[model samples]
Target: MPQMMPINWIFSLFMFIMIFIMFNMLNYYISIIKMNNKMNNNNFLLKKNNWKW
Candidate 1:
């Protein structure tokens, strides 16, 4: 049991780091998607306004 302790610790640390990185990546992509959506919406609004003129 004592010998397995270090291995378990290393595995847990690795998993934690991986999860953290994945979480950051998800947030980064989500923000990028949101920005794209906002830009599309703005373009649509501008087109609509131009038609009015």
Candidate 2:
């Protein structure tokens, strides 16, 4: 007898996983961007106030 796994099932699972990974990557990038913006703003403010590292 042929194995019972359906082709559509496997394809759907792969698609779901790919979408999930993409979402996670997008979320990670957004967080990084937010942090970078915050850091840049702080640096700018500090420079305006004559602060140094």
Candidate 3:
């Protein structure tokens, strides 16, 4: 039982770190997608205004 304790802790810690890293990667990708969408919307608006003029 004593020897198993350290192995269990190590396994849990490794899993926690992996989940944290994946969450950060997801957030980074979402932010990039949002920025690209904003840029496209602005470009569309500018083109519409030019067409009106």
What does candidate 3's lDDT look like per residue over 1-53, in tens digits?
79899999999999999999999999999999999999999999988887543
lDDT of 2 by residue, 8-45 (tens): 78999999999999999999999999999999999999
| Runs of candidate 3 exceeding 4 Å displacement | 51-53
TM-score of each: 0.86, 0.75, 0.83
State which candidate has the highest lDDT. Answer: 1
Candidate 2 collision pairs: none
True lDDT of residue 19, candidate 1: 100
RMSD of each: 1.8, 4.4, 1.9
* Better candidate number, 2 or 3, judged by TM-score: 3
Error of 3 at 8 (Å): 1.0
Q: Which ten residues in a row have the lowest lDDT in candidate 3?
A: 44-53
lDDT of 1 by residue, 1-53 (tens): 79999999999999999999999999999999999999999999998887543
